[model samples]
Target chain A: MKTLRVPEATVTRLSIYSRFLERLDRNGITTVSSGEIAEGVGVSPAQVRKDLAYFGEFGTRGVGYNVKDLLKYTLKILGLDQEWALAIVGAGNLGFALCTYRGFNVRGFHIVGVFDNDPTRIGKRIGDLVVQPLTLFPEIAQKENIRIGVIAVPTSAAQEVADMMVKNGVEAVLNFAPVAINVPDEIEMRNVDLSVKLEILTFNLGFRNAQSL
Target chain B: MKTLRVPEATVTRLSIYSRFLERLDRNGITTVSSGEIAEGVGVSPAQVRKDLAYFGEFGTRGVGYNVKDLLKYTLKILGLDQEWALAIVGAGNLGFALCTYRGFNVRGFHIVGVFDNDPTRIGKRIGDLVVQPLTLFPEIAQKENIRIGVIAVPTSAAQEVADMMVKNGVEAVLNFAPVAINVPDEIEMRNVDLSVKLEILTFNLGFRNAQSL
Candidate 1:
């Protein structure tokens, strides 16, 4: 095995490319060039090639690449080839949204549990799973072999929930608290800043307005 | 005014830098070096300087940057100087979450309208505003002078909703539908892939496991 330090940006692009390839595959397109992939995903062709180069060569010099094979490779690299059991904490509106979000299911992530500390929310049903109290996290985590935990709680409770998740043997965390949370060095963690993309749109709109002046 | 073609990545970094600076401003921090900002935001020092250089020189050679002034500059560059009125389509759980999301309000984005086609959802209250019917979108958009629209509908309705938003005179859109949506060239549009970051974490976790084998 080789020790590879791939840039996080490359991983993000791989995810995007996988989705683009899925579209092409569904559309019955058999082959695609780097240029086509780049155009489909709104990225530069050179950037497409550069990001892919971090992993291994996928496309030919001029004959392009098979869409299905590329898609499979991307998904495999992203660890979507295996079924992942996930637990979403903080069963508020955001947590409920996460539970029903189709994107995770499509990517082979199964939400095994949804937990909350509030007594009223504990017995509530979100999808097929009943919300359990936070105290049951360790028991449910062990019973279900949950590896990934999502923190959808408020800013104040995010770090505490993350700490609890780590203590219960979760390997990775996806935090949606809008605030940064600290985790152990060994844990894989990422913050999903939902508002950042909105800010980007506003920035561009503002830029266009500034240009018109 | 300059017709500058700033990269989308630069806009994203600007948003992150702005948020980090906001935290610093709230903490009463006066000055920050590029290295400090980079450390705080998890970016490289040179990358921080380069991002700021795109707007203009903000820091002295060695004196670093004034936190408040840089915060204001980044916000202005990102169009946060003026309040942005937003309309969220699809008053489901996701839309309801967006309506009350503090992240948007903190960044000067006001959710002036929430719309849905469902009868049950139409008469419901998200916060201070009641959910309106889809037919009322045009009227409310015009009355509230909505400049940005959020499509929180499912993937099946994302494109159609985006088209409607474009027709309703929206200048920008933030899509949470998990599908790629097409908008007119004149409208600023961005897709929020909430599951991509989770996949990235899974990828890294898989990579680390593979390395240790």
Candidate 2:
């Protein structure tokens, strides 16, 4: 089991692997080799083994991996073994969507609170949580023991919101703002740039078009 | 120039290369060898060459590649050179956020229109475009020449929304819905799951914890 040295790319792929494994389990897959998992998730089996090996040898040399055990191991590696209380920073449409976002509650993560600077949105309810003022983030985060922060604010205000989250001792951040935020090396950030994916797809289409010509 | 079919993994890495090249260019880097680009992007120089070779002979035998030229070629290969019109379905939280989503507009892809089933939301304004009923999708999409469809609707309605987009003649789809979609092989689909990212981070953390013990 390696410590905190897992590459960010590896972490990202592990997330993909987790989803694929869940799909496998649902299909009643009782066991899987790294190669099978790789094919299913679109990765090299060696890469899969290397990623899993960062934690330990979950798969036997000749036999394969027990599906349920591997799932548990992946869950543990992702820090999803226990419930993580989440706080959404922006209470706008994206933030509101995230507050009730079905994704969080699915994998041992929960939105415990919502915060916004706007007074109109404050006291509004999304899901079971009521929106609170941004001024109360420090207090509420501490009270709820929130470890992760979701910043869905505008680009102009993203850095300010990120700084606030860092100062309040939040370690992991999921940023949806268009711009990238510079954080200390210790703070883990996974930026969900809705546009980057499209840009990549755009590039893909462009290449395909060029090849056709 | 040899067009060796590069792996999907390699194509994904091109974006990273493009980003690094931009950084190098910004730093006044005019020329770089394959080794340099590989080192900067944390890949093998041979890999860099191989990936670039897929599109065309981007590098000279002696000199590496012109930073700007290589970037432009990669961008073209990725299809970022052309503008894409986007039609979004479901004017809910995700839809509204995407309409105001700064990422898409900055990248040459524009959200020309947003459609929803809710009559109250129809005819309302979001950004520069007016919200229209989902019924108008075929008409508007045809009129606007929308080639890309973005389905930001909830999981329950995602399939129906996708079917409508397909019927409207959108060839590529970016689904933000939680469910897996079934589409014809000719149509390209990419799903963005925010929770999967968190799950990967959790998996890494879990693996580290196990190794330490």
Candidate 3:
């Protein structure tokens, strides 16, 4: 059997839609049209429909979708139905921020461990989890059944940390380091370049400036 | 004069290419083929060429691209050629991390002010700038000529912060808040959903599991 490939943009939109639906569910919004979802998330109605069509038939003609049902479907489709155990390397500000982030917990992501090599940072407490030494990652990861590893370290340490994660049985990695780091082909890896979004804004601003000139 | 609209993805790729080229130039590499760049950034060779084609012709047919020249061109096109004055609202962990994030300064984005409504956070220093009260935003933004505002607040405060920024003459916004935010049509706005990337990984992991089953 062959697996149908979904566009990453579609997957991203699904995540957004899931969050929006969750909000609607909380507000007792029982039904929603594609247009409402689009308006809420700032995408086109057709885009919302097209993205949904990739999975299966949803909603009734003109009657719209059941908010609770859609929310459950999107969550299940995105694999948010189950809690994921995660380990974070680099207990710097970014790591500390990620640990305390409310969004992750709302979406069922649990950070099981935070690790660092800096002697000063190690053993320090970040929220409820105490920062552990990098040497303890393998032990903590295995004990906690951690499948995801987050790289919040500096550029110099990113690659080494990724290697450690891979060696210690981390199935996926979310890298926050500015520089690119190589991981095995089979490992699910994504680079979150925080500055890239800022550059987009700057580009649009520059384009507008160029037009006026 | 009509301005050519470039795809956001192309602009994003250009940013990555520019960073990759910068790394190569720092190592004293002069010229590079599209394939080498594609490999470096994990994109296809054709994609590298297609994205660059939007700006204008670059590089010779057989000689490939001049690394330094391409880097300069990309930086100029992405509006990184000039320094951008920015103000960050919230002064929380995310804001502190952004204030100290090395990537922004490397790309010419300078955080001129950090603001929060909490009296306790105000006057606290992250780096060189001290956190100020929300009431001081307009004055600081005006005096500093801040064009971009960063929203690092909670969901409840995200929209309010956005309104404050727009009212204070912020031309663009980079929202780190999880929820969707509304900005004026002319204001260049983008949301950084950190959890979205994590969801993408989970979705892939789930899909792989389904494929094997």
Candidate 4:
């Protein structure tokens, strides 16, 4: 595997391309050109080729790409070829929604545990999983070999939850709490601020309005 | 307002910086340097300066910036200075979570309506707002002056919801549905794929492991 550092934007686009390929593969589409992939995901044809080129050449000069082959390659490139065990802390509305979200399961992410410190939320069932206490996090994480921890708690508790996750043994964290939480340097962390996207929309609308004026 | 084309990533970083400034302001911190802002949001000092430079200079040479002033500037730049009326379509788990999300309310985003096509979900109450049917979207949107619409529906229903939002006079859309939805060129659209961030973490972990091998 070539370990040249790839741009984060390219990684994001690769995830989109992988999803588009999945849709095509489901529809039984066998072949796809860079233009087709670009059109399917709303990117330029050259961009599609450029992002794919970072990994390796996957298509012929004019033959384009084989849908299944390209899908497999993108999935492998995205580290989705194998299942990842996940533990979601804070069994609140966001956590509940993530627990039931079908997107994660379709992409080889399995929720092994859902946990909360609240007595009211504890023991509640979210699909096949039960909302365990934070006390059970270590045990469950060890048993399930959970690699990823999701912080779904409120702003006040996000940092504490991240600390506990790090101590327990999770390798990476995907934080949903709007606040920034600190983790060890070796642990990979990402924040998914739900409001950021809405703000982007507002910014564009405001910018356009300004331009017209 | 200068109409220079600002990169989307800069806008995103600005949002982070704005949030950090808000935190500082709440703590009664009056002044901040680019280094402090960058440290709070985990970006390089130079990168923070560059992003803010796109909008205009905010900080002094060595005196740093007024916390409240920078906060206001970022909010204004991101169009969060004025309250934006939003209509969220779907009202499922994701929609329910979004309707109750406090982050939106803090940043001047007000949810005026929540709509769902499912009869069972239509009359449900999430927080102070009641979920209405999709039929009432146009009426409520017009009455409430909703400028933004959020699509939290399923993949199959996402495009339909986008079309309804576009037809009902929403200027911008924040789609939470994993699938891509098309809108007219005049309308601004952004997709928030929840799984994409997790894939980034997985990709990094996989790459590190591969490199070690």
TM-score of each model's chain B: 0.94, 0.85, 0.96, 0.97
Worst 10 residues of 4 chain B by lDDT: B99-108
| Candidate 3 C-alpha lDDT tens digits along A41-84 | 98899999999999999999999999999999899889888989
The 10-residue segment of model 1 chain A with minimum total lDDT is: A1-10
- Each prediction's DockQ against the real complex: 0.73, 0.45, 0.72, 0.81
TM-score of 2: 0.81
Q: Model 3: which docking level applies? A: medium
Error of 3 at A126 (Å): 2.4
**Which number leads on DockQ?**
4
lDDT of each: 0.89, 0.80, 0.91, 0.91
**Judged by lDDT against the true structure, how good is candidate 1?**
0.89
Model 3, position B52: C-alpha lDDT score: 90
Chain A TM-scores, all candidates?
A: 0.93, 0.88, 0.96, 0.98
**CAPRI grade of model 2:** acceptable
lDDT (Cα) of model 3: 0.91
The best-first sequence of candidates by lDDT reads 3, 4, 1, 2
For candidate 3, write residues B7-112 as lDDT tens digits. 8889899899999999999999999999999999998999999899888899999999999999998999999999999988988888889988887667879889
- In candidate 3, stretches whose alpha carbon ends up further than 4 angstroms from where it belongs are none
lDDT (Cα, 0-100) at B24 in candidate 2? 88
Better of 1 and 2 by TM-score: 1
